[model samples]
Target: MRIKRPRIRQKIIFTLERQLVKGAHYQLLLLAALIGLISIVGGILVMPSGEPTSTFGESVWWAFLRLSDPGYLGDDQGNWRRFISTLITVAGYVVFLGSLVAVITTWMNRKIRHLEQGLTPVTANNHILILGWSNRTIHIAAEIFQSVGRIRRFLEKYDAKKLQLIILSEEVSSFQMQELKDHPMIGTRAHEIVLRTGLAIDREHLRRVDSLNASCVIVPSLAYGRKELISPDIETIKCLLSLNAEAQAQNNQDLPYVVAEIQDENKINAARRSYTGPLEVIGSNTIISRLMAQNIRHPGLSAVYNEILSQVDDNNLFSQVFPELTGQPMGRLKRAFTRAVVLGIVKSEGEHFSPQLNLPDDYLLEDDVLLVLLAKNSTDLVWRKDRISTDYAPMPFLGMLPVEELENRINILVLGWNEHVPALIRELCTYEDEKYFIRLVGLRPIAEREKELAFLSENGDRVVVENVVADFIRESEIRKLAAETFDHILMVSSDRMEEEEEADARTMVGYVLLEEVLEKASKRPSVLLELSDPSNESLIRRFQSEVIISPMVLSHLLAGIALQRELNSIYNELFTVGGAEIIFRNLPEYGLSSGKKRFDELESLASAHGETILGVYLDRPDASGNHLLLNPAKSHEIGLSDNDRFVVLTTFY
Candidate 1:
């Protein structure tokens, strides 16, 4: 029995210690119990020794004062009372004061650690929800900030006070959060961003961001970097399914507008079937491929796209329906708005809108048709409401030259291969009556690339492809390609590498080798580079080449379309084949020599030829060191020279 008693006592002590260590709440409860025990016991002991305590309750109060504060010990009357007060104060230090401090400190630290983990739920309604983390995440957030004016108007329909961008990713690190906040474009507006840690496919995680309540949800394609379990488009569809399920759970029949990026064009149909809501799915590979193919045909057009896609630029595309201008001819729209340039019209289909550009001058606009305009801001899109005489006509410049001849065939040197390569080849084949001779140099086997592009053989007369497996990073291999003989050189980011940064590093080295090979040649071909990392833009600025950060461009589209759905068709018309395109022509091509002329004069002259004068490309950098100036004041005078070019939007290309 004695042996069993000792064992039981040991077991009881272990149980108490386990309970005390479980959590701060349990430890606090134990401290409170100990304080109660000491007050009662000490009160009984001090009852006979006191004039300060008469009854049992008063005696308990006397003991509690000394236990809670050691200063009460000095006021004790006699020897017994003083000894009891000292004993209670000593017990209070261990049981109440010390333990309470430790418990509170531990609890606070635990809360802070949990908060840093980004697991806490966000309480926001009508906010922008961004799912997944890729190279484009920060840039997407930045563009949203740049387009705040449009977003504010978007929020007005819901009567929301401020803009909020909430992002949920598989993992959230302090470093990633800091990177997003520290981006130059998202600098001070970081307060509007909220990041959480979770997977988009998980319904439990979707609830954390209140996905059903978001004004718009954006799912960026995770096709870059390391491969995942499922394809990027599949993953995006799964995310949409989860969001749909979440909305169903809340008894909400409709989800807010959603803009999701699809990596594969074929999978877009599957994605559309997955989410039956107001949705816009951006085909990332198609967009990038088309832009690259367009830049190959028109050198320096990449810069034009960069300016047009950026919201921070002075001019941007906006679409709105003005009922007052129903019966007006399309050509007279330019005279109606002083600050806005009428680009095209968007006719509504059953459930979608299609952009109709390059219409004849006498084309009359129908009712409820949306006009696509290029303007500095939304405020400049208002109609002037002017009454012009039917006989009024401005004199046109007679300096128009005949159309230039298209080259019979262009030799293109492609360094490295990626997912966009096949799509790029297909896009180049879409041009009518144009020929391209493409020489592909990559690290992969020639047989593999041949199999990948087996369909191109059908268009062999239009595009000739020759694949050679060689390391483009080596200067010797690059020299063998005879890069200078080609009319254009495309350096695609290598997919053979694991990390984006490592892949970009390889691309930079390849660019250097290509430049070295071109130094001794007579012909200087246009060089276009596809880079994944936007941070690498600064390092390669010294090279005279057109750079396409594919992810950044996609981000701009995603953000823009999320704000306004009509932009989807506008971008499609601009980039797609057999549509209105941007082209640059020299002053001599316009049959004009060195002279100064007002920009409005150029605009009026271009109107006669079914072209819009966007801006000027300087022969030499001006005081501002700008090579391209777009959307200048119409009345502003510009010095024109034979070497200078005019950037125009026309279907003539």
Candidate 2:
């Protein structure tokens, strides 16, 4: 007994009904033409004027004149002429009627715009608005949505509402639109949701979601190089200026906060001009390069960072530690803030930032910021005076685990170009162990890097880059150029795209080579990539230890984050401190074999010793092969095999 399906007639009716609501204007225009034609023709044929009927062409010509500028002859006109003209002879009247219709349409549009000021029915007023189109648009939108989702979930338990989001993009093409439609759990918040549109700088589409009225706006960096009419820097400058002009017209110039990405670091001044009131740059790859270069030189640094940056849990992967969290050193901060953890802190003195600092001592947190780890945005920072008295768990500290404990020596092979390579490698050289182990693999040395390299080597630091002369894009050359010469492999884009097809070709070759190496090598060297586009980040993650940073998109993230009060201080403390380093170590004395949890350990341990536990990583189950989940809760227990990274707030210098 199979159920019968709807017939073709029924299906067509259903489809038409669905389309009619949205496409009514098209249908109505057709109807108006038909009705207007019929009224004129029918009235003309039936008129009782005894004169012979005119041809169709004659009727059309007369109708046009009457509708547009009916010229009146003397009142005592001939009967045939008067009869033919009287019924339709009002030019001003028709014009007035059409103008009335247009006015009504404009009124309706204004009303819609007014309603949009409140919120999208789904996202509400507290949602996020992301603008512009770029490769990193997808990645930033995804991460932001996930971040907001986690924040929403946390709020729902307490307030029953969540942060939401809406994204605006340029109508690039059908393929990009198709890509947007395919994503399901973007925002990841209960009330947190996302709506994507091809509408760009147009105010009408922005009015659809109340762009200015939203709590925040995020314009992410372009993880990949996007084409522009002018130089990317100049185009960024001009577009930002125009955007600022629009926002100003609404008296919202300094009212709403804005976040945007800039391609060239040089164009940052223009981004400043575009920002209303307060603005932030979310993914500032330029500044982040110093950190990336430092992290890459040190193995397992990626693991520690993935925890801080990821938006995968209810507790923020990274958070700020409050001043009241006293006596505990950096290592203990991880567990004190709910089940959340601490990586490090910017000190008030701007001097020392050691995870393994002296505890029971005044924890020197950055006066402006405290870098921490939580599943979501923040945890309840109220000092539990009651809990402080009731649950003070103290553990006897054995001794300090020296920084030299981990295997740091690494030989890295990097492909492609990056503007920040010189500064990046320079920071890496500060790590003594990593400094001795690196061999830069590429063709000619970048001129900027040459000065830094010579200086480091002159200072007795073993900074050597064995330039294996070969094209990384050529398949055969990769095998011929000492493929197994390094401990880790990285690929980056050196310059922006001069031509689209050429860049794509280069990326494809690199991707294949990476995959090929993965297939054959027994020890799949840690592979990290700075890809052409942020969207490509997803593609490469399928391998391992891979991250693609889009400078264009990240510039926006940086802008947004910069807008966040106290967050910039935290970021500066976390990254700018010369000696500050984050590491993952094995410590089961705090519980289970492997995986997160250790959120509560820092207090007593730090009370005895000055060690700060930044964060912990576990082979936690996730779509990305046992994801290293960040900022687990206090209740969340861990096994023995887990890697616990204690950030010793000390400089590599």
Candidate 3:
């Protein structure tokens, strides 16, 4: 059987119908043409005998004047001419002028609606494109502004008055967009933000934002809807694929870097396979679990990570090339910078650069290596010869003091359960010479909990996992777990509660109940509280617990990575196990005197113990109650207490 195509006449009709349905301009143009033809014919045929005989051009001009204004008919010398003018004027009012006004008004209304709906395509170059909407967007934007060095470099390179940040999302409302623009942190920056309401995976929407001209793109995992039929990882992967396809179609010479946040670790491999450009996939749950486990093993370690990660303060990790000190030994390089502490060398190997920390004193620095230093600002990277003194004497290699006698078994009490719990358990198991007896108290079936526990037990040694089925919100259930018996208490946020406020409220209840239970005990265990919202940190600070806001941490990390792509390696080395880790050792273990000690002497003392001293944590809090101060001046004197702690970087956990 032969299939027949549509006839030419049918195809023409279909095209015209589509044009008319799409816009009113085509219909208005056709009506105006018909009215002009009628006016011209009528003017030529009906001519008054008293009036001058008119040529075709003259008659057409007269018809135009009469159609434009009905008053032109009064000047007619005869009834015939007046009747013709009246007919033309009636046609003009009924079709030409009437339709013109309708079309113009409709076009204007559409433009206004497009503006309100954020459908207008943004015309910007070298902008940062954020492709999703969530509570974390505001924080992420703030962090970008806080990165002063990165912003300044971007503005200088583009010769732009202000950097642009374009947010493309269908879920954000006008009010929310306005709120973000008016936020104190973001509004104060030398930047402008544009909002476009559309799906990230849509190619047209990508074009609207000028994605090809963007400097970078951020795809935050979507947290919308009750049950994610399509997981956030899958959505992020789809967005990445769409962006890659668009860039490929455009034949872009340089595709912008993409930093995507994914929830599932298993899906990261799939997301990676979808893009060919420079892509960074951050698994928030996995990283948070690693951070939480690290914090549990070493208290106040989160502060160190926060300081290094954030750029709001002067104490941040910075990498710079020092050509003059290329061949200098690593030890000499460390001593050269009195104001800044040399952490490691960033050695470029093949296509990537990795941080080499705690290098031997005799190890000479290569010309291609960049020094990583902890300083208040990049401007402080300059070496000051006057700051280095010859008065400081080398300290002997006195071994660390014996460990304080304490309980051999460590008890950990977890008050809630989420997807991060399993990862947290596995991370906790990585530490050696520690016996961990972890008890989980949640509202899940014991069998299900044991399944995860069984897996961890088989994979890790020296860790015991147990679960108790109960509503942790109830004080009776919380007390039944013997809160005082545990050495550490961990409060996990509930993922089932979609509302951040509600989830935080439940966490708060559990924290208060545990506080009451441990009040009567002789020894009060340390508490680690996980909060979804960072704004609530101030509210919960009075409880005097170690609070970790996972969303805020993720926001900071994403912002850092977006600003400096090379920082991805630095963070990976800092967070994960099997490398140099941040740990706090008691000051008394170093055998220092009670009187004031110079910062350099302390650094030398720490070096003898095969560790690098970053800073000290005072046992007694200062005015603001902050105990940690990193990379203090060499001349600064520290009055150490028996309980004071030293923040150091060592190979051991």
Candidate 4:
């Protein structure tokens, strides 16, 4: 049977009707329109009964001109003058009232927008709270969402329908929230979000996020504070300190953790000295510089970042603390973390400030910090891919490297100038060994302007920088660099954005130059670009940039911290200290690798070899390794294959 269609008006009805109400000024506007129309009509009808006023139209016409002044009444206007005067009086009243309403409505709109900028508290507890507004905050929210949603399904195994997350900022908008709004994982109705803009140093505003109750607070890298005396760093430090002070006052038995970003190393040291709270700082300069250098040398750096950050499915990450590592050397566990491509390790004793600088101390395994990365399952990982069968292959998660193909030493190139470069170069030099070759392609006898480069290349001081005075923006200049064999190239735009457009232009030029290099090169390499603006991110992405770093987003997260100033400390713990990493692991195909398989057996095999298992993946790189289960149940089927890789976090590696 055919169903009857609803009436057009009924079908078009929306719940938004209750949300929006016509303002009083709008009513006044309608009245004003009516009055204005009447005044015009009345003025025309009030024309004088002149020689030509014998016709009804002639009299009205004569009166129309006389309304604005008595001059029209001089030429035998007669009693028509009285009608003209009356019409002007009515028009005056209508105009005055209309103008008054216009001003009032504008004022009302301003106030409404202001009020809408405030925040709403969520009833959900133990949820991750993201503060401020920027690109990183978007990623932070997504990461936490994926983290908790899985925790609920497998650990708490709660219904995914009720997951809760809160973001408080004045800058949150529908455009910025597109990714979250489109994600089906949120399991809720859509809401265009723009957080109430607030200074990070403002304590009262920080409370809007209820920092004390959040599971973790992520303070991102930097915020552009152009034309302002107070840099975002100073603002972030003050805000973090205030948050710590507030937490002490509340005496809350269960305040959440704080994760922050530190732009400068010295500031990071100072921050660590002050706050004793649970905090971390992600070194913006160190990471950006290193990544930039990598991208500058090899274009694949962007591809690596894409793999590192991707979170779709069976590509999620897991972190684990290695117990057996206490007595074992990290070299032994490298196989474990490396079989799955372990990213970094958290230090055991004190927090780490720069991941780019620190190597595992002999005590890396003994450290209290946890190691993190992506994995196929909580159980120990298995490498397969050698065998094939008629039935579905097992353990396909690991993107196993082909045995015949040799892993080439990574190439790195750095361009542009920034204070962070010296530290970045220092850290990068430490990583070079048998597997990596690093060359500095720049000018020699560096000019006074190249002092920053001189400082960063301190370790490589004797190895003078190649002084090539090529404008990085010119495609031909970039092509010459691309001619040399390299794996990646990093473009850094440290120029000031004070001109309002300078930063963007500089960044665009940098991005264009990098793209041009890759484009003109007979062989394509990886590309990583950096900028200070999150607003221009889309434009940069248009260049097909693989890795782009923005300090602005990091600054937004930095504002979320309370008084203790623990934000940087947390970043130190996770990123710098190897507290968290992204790794790739392989799964077996011939064997039955389901959750039904005993985890301890696989764990025993990995442990017999000193592996620390965290999570599993199903070999889908772009899907975010979502297919692999983390800390799976004893009976959950392990859906993996040799083609698939897993992410593992181990204290040893």
Candidate number of the best TM-score: 1
Q: Select the stronger candidate by lDDT from 3 and 4.
A: 3
The residue-by-residue lDDT of candidate 4 on 56-135, one tens digit each, is 56554444444334454445544655555555545544454554566577668867765555544334455555655644
Q: Candidate 3: minimum summed lDDT over ten consecutive residues — where?
A: 398-407
Query: Residue 307 in candidate 4 has what lDDT?
Result: 36
lDDT of 2 by residue, 1-653 (tens): 99998699989787666654554365455445644674466346434443332555555545545544446434314666565566555432554346446645765886775443433333356566666665555555555544543355434533536455566655434465456555453422323334445344555556655665666666554444545464444544444454566677777744445556554455677677665455544325445565566466455565545434432343333334465654444433433456444445433333223332223333444444555443445344433344444344446555554555335456677676555555456556655454445445455555644664565655354566654445687667777655565677767665556543355557656767767756776666766665554345565555556564444224334432522333444555456535445544445443335443344543345334445554444444455565454444555454434344433333333
lDDT of each: 0.83, 0.50, 0.76, 0.48
* Winner by TM-score between candidate 4 and candidate 2: 2
- lDDT tens readout by residue for model 3, 174-253: 68667676766776452366778888888888998898788889888754343647766777888888888998899986
For model 1, which pairs clash?
none
To one decimal, what is the Cα RMSD in angstroms of model 1 from the true structure?
Answer: 3.4
Q: Which prediction has the highest lDDT against the true structure? A: 1
Using all chains and alpha carbons, the TM-scores for the candidates as numbered come to 0.90, 0.60, 0.82, 0.52
Worst 10 residues of 1 by lDDT: 394-403
Global fold similarity of model 3 (TM-score)? 0.82
Rank the candidate models, highest lDDT first. Answer: 1, 3, 2, 4
In the order shown, the candidates' Cα RMSDs to the true structure are: 3.4, 13.5, 5.4, 16.1
Error of 4 at 304 (Å): 5.3
Clashing pairs in 3: 314-376
Winner on lDDT between 1 and 2 is 1
Output the worst ten-in-a-row residue range by lDDT, candidate 4: 387-396
- TM-score quality measure for candidate 1: 0.90
